[model samples]
Target chain A: MSRAYNFCAGPATLPEQVLLQARDEMLDWRGTGMSVMEMSHRSDEFVEIAETAEQDVRDLAGISDDYAVLFMQGGASSQFATVPLNLLGNSASADYVNTGIWSEKAIAEARRYGDVNVVASSAGCGFTTVPDQTGWKTRADAAYLHYTPNETIGGLEFDFVPDSGKVPLVADMSSSMLSCPVDVSKFGLIYAGAQKNIGPSGLVVVIVRKDLLGKAHVKIPTMMNYQVMADNASMFNTPATYSWYLTGLVFKWLKDQGGVSAIGELNARKAKKLYHFIDTNPLYSNPIDPRFRSRMNVPFILADEALNSAFLKGADERQLLNLKGHRSVGGMRASIYNAMPEAGVDALIFYMAEFAKERG
Target chain B: MSRAYNFCAGPATLPEQVLLQARDEMLDWRGTGMSVMEMSHRSDEFVEIAETAEQDVRDLAGISDDYAVLFMQGGASSQFATVPLNLLGNSASADYVNTGIWSEKAIAEARRYGDVNVVASSAGCGFTTVPDQTGWKTRADAAYLHYTPNETIGGLEFDFVPDSGKVPLVADMSSSMLSCPVDVSKFGLIYAGAQKNIGPSGLVVVIVRKDLLGKAHVKIPTMMNYQVMADNASMFNTPATYSWYLTGLVFKWLKDQGGVSAIGELNARKAKKLYHFIDTNPLYSNPIDPRFRSRMNVPFILADEALNSAFLKGADERQLLNLKGHRSVGGMRASIYNAMPEAGVDALIFYMAEFAKERG
Candidate 1:
């Protein structure tokens, strides 16, 4: 089977090895006579699968004992509302750092539950960079500070973690988690939708400090309540088992490649190679601030707007797919997630250079 | 590959054909060069898949243009809150018929949003039968009447659809959808969790009257808003694409086998064969009211409680898996969904008679 390099920001490309493993095990998982999707969530077979997936995620993230890993549904967008519903217990407010579309969405959802302080915003600069955190006007008694580590749409990323002082830091690492190494003890909670770096679209991985459990407002739905999910080990309902299983396979693949640090080095190299081509080539340009360009999603615009379609057409002809940028930020984006090999990056760079030379 | 008969109530048994097809297409679907799970939801490929799935469901259910079909996530449990949040509008109350565990849970969640009128309740009868609709205490101004057509745990199903005149009728048909033929226009809305009969656990199908759109309370999350989902054709967020695809295949299979009418006949025959064995056998009995016995889920008990373990063990030895009943009512439950062939029912009946005769 010929598979293209899928650069879609999410429901993005997964490790080919993981796909092959899933295909092999689709009918029977490890002699369990049933497909993972058919196994009861409560059964020993599924329980082990779920546990191993959670454990592997924890290992990859270097999650500490203080943090509880949750496998949840409804994607990261649901968590935009659930995070506030669970974290902002009695407090009437929270601080938000608006870096791009995703961060702005988090702030808007949080406003439904409490007062939101726009502690830092790059909106004034067209979401090209992360605003200076020192300028943030944080509330003294705010429940927590929320931010998106990588803005998938704008292709902007935070180069460093923000210091929240006494306030708990919550990061929506949907597009960036597992692409690099992170200090687990530094944040109160980190959540990522598994589509990009982890596995599939339906499952979300959440790591929250244990102390934050059981503090959700009574109004939170049982499924959205963190403590209940934590107590039940993310089996409060039948999870997306197939996605979780795929995630487990992806996690195993990550370990085989020498864990997160090793993958991080490779991801950085892939990002640098692609960025260097875009920088040297006059026919294409990436507008994000140099210090904050995302390693995962790289959005670029054509020198000639009319050539945008031709560029995408030429790329598609070469089997480089999903490079069209988000409609909200129209241009082009090549998301190079962990599953994307350096070879795929090199192929993309070669294609870009060839396309530029022909156009020039 | 050897496969076992999985008896999970939800995330339960799937047609072997679907699994085989899914495995074959795991890498490339119809030469698309990408798995259904990896395709962008907005891409023409996925859009075609989603549309075909919806069209097949409509054909299977005989749904008309007046009805809107929506595929959503978070299972039917999320809809417990979303249904009330959407339909309640300016109305201060809604009517809920409490038949068993699922309905009771739905009532509890709905109570958080508006006053819930317990129109009828079978809890007094230990949830073994549907409460008489004539005795219902529905409010005159209730925005809608909600009911679960089949209770998976209690193995009780409504014998007749309740007549609500102008009051919009909403039914959670999670366990019984596509198992029988029903007049689609008779009810204002119908929702089902896919695991049991549709496909897998993550996808929830909702059919609503067009007039019900846009009434969602301002506070409801966009993911939960029926209007938003309907407007976007259930692509408001990244959907459970693989599950949706599987459900589409299941729908095609059902259509090929002469749609719901033929399946319903088979389902009835299966239920009768199993129930007749329990009724006539001195060593086994089913306590649910015969009038309300579910054609999908058949729960029974061993007359000699001590032999329950032996019964389950023998069934396991014979490969009659998942025959063990729900935890709340522990004895045995044989869920005969659309996929369970008549031969499976015959095998189950033969085993039950053989085990009963030997034990007696």
Candidate 2:
């Protein structure tokens, strides 16, 4: 089977091996006489699948006893509303760090629930850099400080985690989750939509410090209540089972590849190879601050705007697909996610150099 | 190529042909070089998939121009909250007819959003029959009247649609949708969890009248807002693409085997065959009132409850699995959904007779 290297921001590429395994097990799963999708969530067969998926996540993320990991639906967007509903408690305010489009969206949703304090913003800098943490104006009694670690749209990332002292810190790690090692204990909550580096689009993984549970406002629906979800193992309602199963397979594949540490090295190499080419080549330019350039999503503009279509068309001919940047950013983005092999990046770099030489 | 007859309640059986087609197109969907799961929701490929899926649903359900069909997540349970949130509007209350576990759950969730008047209830009769609509004490100005047409757990079904007049009728058809033909014009809204008769667990099909849009309370999250989902074509967030794709295939298969009108006849025949066997056999009994018996889920008890273990074991040995009744109602329930062939029911009847004879 010929598979092109996919570079879409999300609903993105998945490990080819996981797809093959899924296909092989599509009819019957381990003598259970049913596919994972066909198994009832309450069935012992599916209970094991859910449990193993959670266990793999815990192992990979090094989550401690203080954190509860939940596999939920409605994507990260759902979490935008859910986070505030669960965390705000009696407090009517929270701090938001605006790094890019995603954080802005999160802040917008949070405002409906409470008073949002824009602690620091990179918007004034064209969202190309992470604002200095010292510039944040956080309320001492705010519910929590929320930020997005990597913004898929702007290809901006935070090189370091922010400190919130006693106050809880919540991060939307949708685009950068599992791409590198993370200290699970540092944040009060961390949530990521699975489309980028986990497995599928429909499932969202949330890790919340245990003490934060059971504080959702009384008006919160059962499905949106973190405490209820944690109590029921995220099965308070029917979960996105097939997506969860695919996530489990991807987790297993990650472990077999020596966990996040090993994958992180390979990812660093891939990003460096591409970023280095763009930096030196006159034909290409990436505007994001060097410190905050996302390793997963690399957005670059061609020197001549007219050549943009030609670049994408030529790339498509060579079997490189979904390289167009997000419409908000309007350029080209090469999302070298975990599923993307280093060879894919090398091929892209080779093509870029050839294009530059021919154009010059 | 071996496949078991899956008897799961939700996340249940799918058309074998649909699964086969999904498997065939798993890697490269229609030369897009991407799995349906990998395609961008905005891409022309997925847009076509989404449009065709909606059109197929419209065709199968005979939906008129006045109705809008939405593909949503969170299952029927989410709709419990969303229904009232969207329709309750400026009204402080709505009327709910409680028939079984599902309707009770709906009422409980609706209570969180608004005052729910229990217009009628079958719990008084142990959920064996639907309450007479004539006796319903519905509010004079209820925003809407909600009921479950078929309760999968209780094995009770409403033989006739309730006349709500201008109050607008909403039905949870999760267990009975498309099992038969109905006048779509009678109800303001209808929603079905796809697992039972539609496709899979994660996708819910919501059919709402065009007039019901934009009435949601101000604080309702954008994802749960019916109007937002309708406007976005259910792509407000990443949907369950695989489940949606399978549902589209099922719609095509249904069209091939004649529309809902023809399928309804086959379903009625299947239910009659099983019910006749139970009514005549001395050892088998179904407690549901005959008029309210469900054609989709038939729950029967062995006269000698001790033989329950033996009955289930025998059925499993014959590859008739998941015949064990719901825990709340301890008896055998054979969910003969749309995908269960007549031969499967025949096999079930033959086994039931043999088991009864041996026990006697």
Candidate 3:
């Protein structure tokens, strides 16, 4: 069997080893006589799988016992509303840092629940870089500050974690989590849609500081209540069990690769190699400033506009799949997520050089 | 690969054909060179999959164009909250027929959204039967009538759809959907958690009459809004894609077996055969009234209570898996979902008879 290097953002590439491992166990898991899909969520077998995933994630992140790891459904978009619902508490306002499309959506959803103060915004600069922290107007009385560390659409990323002072820092890390090392204690909460750099499309991994629990507005749905989710250990209802199982496999994969720090070094190298090719090529140009360029999603444009379609077609023919950029920015993007091997990056660079040489 | 017949109540049994089909395609789906889990939801290939599943469901249920089919996450428990948040429009109270634990939970969740009236309750009968419709105190002013057609834990099912007059009839068919033929036109909405008879956990299927749209309260989250879901065809957010694909396969499996009607007949026969053994044996008894006994889940108790542990152990040794009942009920239950072949029922009976003969 052959596999293509998939670079579509969000529901992007997964480790081939994990997929093969899952395929081998598709019919029966550990002599259980049924697939994980067929096992009850309350069963001891499944509970062990869920608990092990939780412990592994905590260990990978060095997450303190003060934090709760919730394996939830409805993706990160759902958390746009869930964050405000669970964190706004009795406070009248929440502060938001707008970086790109993802942060804008989060800001808009938070407004539905409470007053939102735009503490920082890079939209004024055409989403090219993270605005300097000194220009921001942060509120002391605000419930929490929210931001997206990596904007998958425009390929912009924050190089530094914001200092929230006394306020809890909340971040939508959908495109960036588990890609590198992170300081768990630096944020009040972190959330990610598990389609990118994680497992499947429908699940979300939410890590909320335990102290933030039980403060949701009385009217929010139980499924969206972090406290309730934490209390139940994220099994508030039948979770996306299959996704959780796959994610556990992924956590083990990360561990086998020497945890997040080692993966971070490799991820940095992968991004550096791909960007080096794009930087030196006459036919290709990456628009974002070097400081803010994302490692996971790299959106590059062609010097000759008409070659865009041909470039993508040629890439596909060569079994380099899903390299088309986001529609809003019509060019080409190779999202080199953590699952992408360095060899895949080398292949991408080889193809890009050949394409540029032929076009030039 | 040896496969066991699993009788688990929720994340219960799935069709072996579906499992085999999924296993074969796990590495490369339809030569796309990527697993379905890795494909973008907006990609033509994945969208075709999502559309085909919707169409197949509409075909299987004989659903009309006036109804919208939504593939959602968070299970039936989330829908307990979603139902009221979406359907409790311009009415002070919603009516709920309390049959068992599921209805109890639904009633509690609906009260969080609006006034809920227990129109009829079988709780007085220790949840052994459904309260007759004639005794119901259903309100004409109610926005809708809610009921669970099959209670998985209690093993009671409503054999007839409740008449809500002008009020929209909403039914939770989680454990009962696809097990029988039903008149979709009879109810304003039908929803089923896809674990039992459909596919996997985490995906919930909702079929709603189109007119019910545009009435949800403004405070409701966009993801939970039926109007938004209908407008987006349930790709309002990235859906449980893999689960949706497997359900499509299960739909095809049902169609191959002559659709829901034929499956309904087989399900009835399976339940009847299992019930016959329990009824005839001096060592066993089924508590639920025959009229309310679920076609999908059969809960039976042993006359010699001390033999319960031994009965389950022996059954497991004989390969009758998950015959252990709900934790709340504490007896034995065999969830004969659409995936369970009649041969499985025969094996169950064979074990039950031998165990009884040895014990008696």
lDDT of 2 by residue, B254-351 (tens): 88879899999999999999999999999999999999899999999988899999888888777777888888888889898898888889999999
TM-scores of the models, in the given order?
0.98, 0.98, 0.99
User: What are the C-alpha RMSDs, in order, of all predicted structures?
Assistant: 1.4, 1.2, 1.0
lDDT of 2 at B294: 94
* Model with the higher lDDT, candidate 1 or 3: 3
In model 2, residue pairs whose N, Cα or C atoms come closer than 3 Å (at least 3 residues apart or on different chains), thus clashing, are none
Per candidate, chain B TM-score? Answer: 0.98, 0.98, 0.98
True contacts kept of each: 0.60, 0.48, 0.67
Candidate numbers, best DockQ first, in rank order: 3, 1, 2
Q: So what's the TM-score on candidate 1? A: 0.98
Tell me what TM-score chain A of model 2 achieves: 0.99
For candidate 3, give the DockQ: 0.73
DockQ of 1: 0.66
Clashes of each: 0, 0, 0
Interface RMSD for each predicted structure: 1.6, 1.7, 1.3
Query: What's the true lDDT of residue B222 in model 3?
Result: 80
Q: RMSD to the native, candidate 2?
A: 1.2
Deviation from native of the Cα of residue B141 in model 3, angstroms: 1.4
What residue runs in model 1 are displaced by over 4 Å at the alpha carbon?
Answer: none
